[model samples]
Structures are given as C-alpha cells and as structure tokens.
Target: MSAARDWLFADIGGTHVRLCRWGRENGAGDIVRMRADASAGVADALLGFERAQTQPAAHAALAIALPVRRGPLRMTNRDWILDPESLRATLRLRTLCVVNDFVAAAAGVPVLGERDSLVLREGVPGPGSRLLIGPGTGLGVAALIGTTGGDERVLASEAGHMGLAWQGAEIDALHGLGRTRWGRLSWERLLSGEGLGWLHAWRSGAATPAPAPEVASRAAQGERAAREATQWFSRLLGAFAGDLCLAFGADAGVWLTGGVLDGLAETFDAAAFLEAFDDKGRYAATQREVPVRRVLAGDLAFRGLARIVDGACRAPMLRLSAATTHRHRN
Candidate 1:
C-alpha cells in the first residue's frame, strides 16, 4: 500500500471513455480518450493500454455513470453491462473498484483547490452534507455526508429518473411538450444536452432538432428562440437543484459538473439560476445560504480515483451480486 504503486484509472461515460495510468511517484500519467463503442468491451480497451505500459497495473479504479447496486449493473445510457469478476479475471488485477461517477466527483470536493472550481454563490457551508448535480449524456446526483474530523462519505443516486415537478407555467409548458414524446418527463429529459435540443424544438416548434452546443452558439448569434430555450433550461436546472437541496438536507453546498453546463459557461444566466434556485418559499433563506459552484477540474474524478487508490478516501468496496451475470460483446 504505497503511493508509488502502479494503478489504472478509467472514467467511462456513454459517449467517451477516459483512461490513464498512475505511477508510484509522479502521480497520473498522460490521460487518453477512446470512443465507448458498444462493440468493444472495456476489458479489451484496458488491455490495449496495458500493452503500452511497462507493466500491468495491480489495481484499477473505475467510475461509470450507472447504478452499481444489487444485481447486474446495467448502464443507463448504453447497452454495455459490466461484471467485476469478469473484469478482474480478464485484466489480472488484484483489486477493482467501480463507483458511481457522481460519487467519484463528490470525492474530489475536499481535494479541490480554488483553481479547480468557479464559485457561483459565496455562502459558508453548514456541517450537514454537500450535494452534486450534473447533466452530461445523462443527469448525475450524489451526496457527501459530513462527519467528524472533516471526513465525508459519498452516496450515489439515480435521481434523473425522478418525476419532474412543477416550477412555473414555463416548466409546465415544457413538460407538456416533452411528455408528448417521453410519456413521463424527468429532469434529465429537459436538462441535458439532448434535452436542450428538445427544449429548443419545443420552443421554436421546429421539426428539425439541433444539438445543444449548436443551440448555444446560435443563441450567442442572437437566435431568439435558442436564447429563450437556453434560459428556460437554466431556470429548470435551478429549480431542480433547489429541490435536491431540500431532499438531501445538503445545507453545506452544491457543485455543478458535466459538459453541458460547461458548454453553457458563456451564455448561461447565472442570475436566473440563482433566482430559481432560491425561490423555495419557506426554505428560501436556507437555500440562499447554501453555496453553489461549478467544478473547473476536468480530471476531478480521476483525482478521486487516485485518492481511492491512495486510501485517502473511503469509497465503497466493489460488490458483486451472488447472481452476477457477465456479458461480453465481440
């Protein structure tokens, strides 16, 4: 259990897979990205990386955007299924840790420096807990339970599928449009990149939908409808953040992550977000005191992985259901 031990790290998402190797003394090696092709399994991908390294890693720390509780952990956004036993045997590792991506993101909080995040609200965090919410290929939620001696425990959740609640007439109208296609609307349906595009379509009544980045770019160019939709998206995101704060009792603070929020950095209405975020009637004062910030560290999760491997953070041990089933794609 030395800091100089060789270890492999991965952050798997729906569209991309990030891989890097950490050495004993120098910290993380060069980070690399590869497409998360359903046709190629993660085992094969890791092997390719190992081939380039001087030696195979003794342990691996992986974070994925899916539920790893109970039975087989099926990816929410992709068809790939992962079994820890299969991976351990195939990669020839002594240990493997698979955590919810948000959990890893949450783990990175204590270690985050001022240069790693942009502060949106400057409030003194209470000792309760910290909340994290982000929308990328999907929405992710996690809580960091505060403890004595400043140690925190991470709790991962699949809150994206939770029913979207009403914020105002605008959210109601947006729901009406979304439900027509998705049947029951969830926050992720309207808060993610794809959701942003859908929001633009619903607002403009345009049959052809555009990607979220394009919508943001167009909005920057004075596209009225795109601008309006982006505003609505921010408002809804604020409302959701407020609701999560109440649910989790996270009086400490909240951190916004993911590429969607990052892409909207230039055009996002920070004031509007704060307005909706603190709009809770009775709890407005409480919500107002909760800090909100955006993570600036792109490698936070991997850093968290390093912490896990270094035993600096106490992440949940990877568990396998008694009935664990393995699926291979070749």
Candidate 2:
C-alpha cells in the first residue's frame, strides 16, 4: 500500500500571504515545500501551482484572519474580501478547509511546545480555559474550548472591537484618542496599530505622521517622546492581558501574538508588565494566578490548519478517488 499524498496550506496575514505544499518524502514523516506568496489579492499568486505538470492534490487548507460564513468574507483590518467557494473551485482541491486565523493559531498550541513560547507568569492558570489575544494591524482573540464530543475547538472572538476598558489615566487617553476621529472610545481605539500611533501622539503632545512606520522608527532611535509612547503601548498591553485572564477565568493563562508584539518585545519588560496586569483592583490575586505567554511561532496558524484538514499533515486520506495517484519510488 502506498502512503503518500500532497496537502496544501497557507497563512494570510494583514500585510502578506504565504502558501506552501506538504507531503511525505520517504514514507515516514511529512515535509513542506518552500513557502510561496499568494499575495494580498492583487493578482492570483497560484498561477505557477496551476500550471505545474503534476496533477494537483486532493485536499488543501487556508487559514485567514477573516470571517468565513459562506459567501463573502471581508477582513476586519484589510481590503481583501475572499469568496471561499470561488477560491476552492479555482484551486480545484477536493477538500479546502477555511478557518479563522486565531482559531488556527489556537489549534496549533498543542504542537507548538515550549521553545515557541515565552513565559510571563509563574502560577497555575486554574480551571479556566486558555485565551489568545493579539494586537497588531488589528486585534485578534480566541478561546480554546474543550468540546463535549471529546475534541477541542478554537472559538474566534470580536472582543477586540468590544469596547475600550477605561480606568484611571487610560480614560483621559482614550477620550483624547476618540475625539481625534470619533465621539466615543472603542477597544480598537487604543489596541491597534493606528491606535498605538494615536497614543504615542497624545502622550508626546505632538502630531502623528501619516504612516505608523515612522512612529516605530523614532522610538527605536531613542527619542524620549517616542520611547514614552512605546512604554504606554506596553502598559496597555499588560492591562488588557489582565482583563482577558479575568473574563475567561483563564487561570490557564493567555497568549500574545502577531507582528506588533514581535517589534515591541524589547520595549516591554514581562515582569513589569505582569505587575500592571495584577494591579487590577480586587482581582489582584486572580491576576497573579494567570500567566502571559507570547506566541512567537509564526507558522502556528498554518500548521493548525493542516491539522484540521487531517489528524496529521499526511494522515490517511478521507477522500480518495481512482485518480488519487499514489506515486511510488523504486
């Protein structure tokens, strides 16, 4: 019996797209092809894959940060809107699983292991489930739900847009940010990339530039005002972490991910961050019980999508046809 079949996967972020193929090499573990671009909807990035002489795979999976209801999926933080059925037809994959990005990320947690994680607390996470929240081009949230069917599901969240948590000085800052464009503060008001820039501007009492890249660059170069902006950014992240821990009863801790966290790693001290997180009035001890970890594994969501497609990347196929060629090596 032959044990080889090809599978496809991709991770589409707000700023870029990555696509890859995976299959067994020598009848053992699965391996992946070099990642290719399925760029942000400008042109079809799968043209080469379509033209390949080899017959295509029977299954594929796409992990996107957009809602996948049935028809149209407009991304929360970007201009790309994808038609899942249309994409599946174009790819000609018999089984193309569409999943939420945060769900995908949460699914891969089991395989991600320790090396891919960074510890920010030391206590037990308790009976509460794990929560994942990330602030970047947009904010992402998910809950790792244990199912009654003896399986697990990652529930996607719109909590980022829920509402801004205002307290003490944060209220004034959010009010100022809200007035810049709107009349009231929303969670995205102080939790997204653009929001970070606004916070930096308000804290520095200076006018923010057109693009956000400038704000980061100025901070990295040691401008006192810019540094304070970055510091405030870290402070808010800590506060939000505390809120998530409380909301989910996630004594199991919470995770932080995405590109923005990647760059701000150095600016924020995890210990100091935890201190602010625990400063949550009456919930102080509960806050201390939860920990925070940064999800640095970039391919987390990609690998998770692969699992949803099959138990493992190259697990026994669920859909097979006569044309399902099993290429054998001598």
Candidate 3:
C-alpha cells in the first residue's frame, strides 16, 4: 500500500481559520478559509476538512493566535477556547503540535518569496535575529534566531502586551485615553482593528464606533477624520515596531504582518511610518540600518506549520514548552 502521506496544517486567528493539506509531493493544497465565530466548532471544521482525504492525516500542526503555554487556550481577541487533549482525541491524530501563530510566521521567513513581501526599508539583513510582528485581532510577536549552521529557531513572545510607548503630545493624549479607559494599555490596544476603531472614535467624536475596514474605506473617499486616524495608526505602529526591533536586537530585519496592515498596504503612509520607525533618538542610526518589510503571503502561519510537520524546522515541545514560556510579561 502507498504510504499514508497526508498532513494537516491550520492557522487559527481571531477572525478566520485557514486550513491546508500537505501532500506526498510536498505541496500544499488550496487554503480553506473559514470564519472563526461563535457558531464554528473547531472540531467540526477539522472533521469537515478531513472527510476529503483518502486516509487520515498522520500528523497535524496548528498555529494559533493566542499564547500556547498549555492546554485550554483562550484567544486574546475572540470568544473561542481550545483544549489540546480534546482536539487530539476528536481529530484522531497520532501527533498534534500547537504553537503560537507568530512562531510559525517566523519559521516561514526562510521561504518567503520575493513577491511575497514589500520592502519598506532596504537595509541588508545581518547574520543575526529577524523579527516578526503582526497586528490582527491582537498583536503577535516572535523572533527567528539564526545559527552558525544556517538553521533558525523561532522564539515566541507576548511583546504585544508591552506598554504602549511613543513620543509627541498627540500620541500622549491617545495614551491618556487608553489608560483612562483600560487602566493599562499595551501595544495591542492601539495597533489592532479594535484600536483603529477607538482611534477613529477619538478623532471623529463619533458616538457609535465603526469597524476598521469601514474607516479605511472612508479614508479612501477623502474623509479627513478617517484619513488622519489611519495616518496616526500607521505612524504609531511604526514607532512600536521600532521599539520591538531594538528590544529584540533584530538587526537582520523586521517583518510586519496581520490583516490590519495588509488591508492598509496601498493606502498606509509608508513614508510617515518610516519616519517614526527611524526616530529613535541616539539609536536612530542603528534603527535606520534595520530593514522593515510587510509580509504579503496569505496563510503564512499555515505554511510554517507545514514546515514543522515536514521536519524542515525544529520540532516544538508541544504543550509543555507553551506552558513554560506562555506568560505575556515584557
């Protein structure tokens, strides 16, 4: 009999779940994107995908947006929770590996295509660490540690929860608003979709908030408030990314991902973003030397999962490693 060659990979985010099948030829099939809302059962989605396979998959890897230190993980930006043990039983897999979604994105860096990203800065990548940060439902961060052997190991982080830091009175006022409402503010609070809504409301004085996509659409139609909110959003995001780059010593490069940035790619003020990214007082020189790019590949976490299941990357410690380093402290 032919060897059982099916492997499964999933990138579970707050808004959507992307699932793909890796075949014996080492190629992935079309990504199956599903909305991740109250009605979507994780098990049901997996089973539905599994029914198309000739034989059950031998292994599965899931890159989830939430921190993965142990079992029963609740998403930071959504109302869904997952139990690894239950998923293993329900999916009937020989091995199941769950990793932070950013970890997987870091792993896929080695394979990111030339057309897969836009270079925001042109600094050559040093033989050091690379940073990956994405602002989706919440912010995601991770680093790819480069070794002398040319291999890379992904280190997951909860850097999104790090305090929101910026320079300028306008940003300070926004910070004040965040602090007043939440008592504590992280980078995620102001750099995500919900963050964009809050910014729009703060700028436009709208009694009712609007979704982020609508704000972007309005901005395109020459709405001043939406335009300014989007501009500040990009600018603040740049400054936050610069802080992360320095903190991690990611001299190689920094990659931006997530649906928020992705949607604003064409309209986002790239020059303004670069200005904030390079405005780190004394460290400005080094910051300017570090490259920045936006990942354009869809389902990047899913691709990273494929790399892990195919033995192209380090094998994760599954649930144990997640629990040990799962704390989201700076």
Which candidate tops lDDT?
Answer: 1
* Cα distance off (Å), candidate 3, residue 182: 1.9
In angstroms, give how far residue 12 of model 2 lies from its true place: 1.3
Could you tell me the lDDT of residue 47 within candidate 2?
40
**Candidate 3 lDDT, 1-330, residue by residue in tens:** 124447678888888888887755757777888787633666767888788877787667788877775658787877778777788777777667788888888888778889999998889677668899888888899988865235657788899998887756776666777778888878898889888888888789886568989988888888999888888888988898888788888899999999888776576888888889889999998888888899998967866776665666662436322223233211
Give RMSD to native, each candidate. Answer: 4.1, 6.5, 3.5
Off by over 4 Å in 2: 1-5, 24-43, 46-55, 147-150, 170-173, 210-213, 311-330
For model 2 the TM-score comes to 0.82
lDDT of 2 by residue, 73-151 (tens): 7877667787655666676766566677777777776576788988866577565677888777777777775532345
Cα deviation at 219, candidate 1, in Å, is 2.0
Name the TM-score of candidate 3.
Answer: 0.91
TM per prediction: 0.91, 0.82, 0.91
Question: Sorted on lDDT, highest at the top, how do the candidates line up?
Answer: 1, 3, 2
- Runs off by more than 4 Å, candidate 1: 1-5, 147-151, 319-330
Per-candidate Cα lDDT values, in order, are 0.80, 0.64, 0.78
Q: Which segments of model 3 are wrong by more than 4 Å?
A: 1-5, 147-149, 315-330
* Deviation in Å, model 2, residue 209 alpha carbon: 4.0
The TM-score of candidate 1 is 0.91
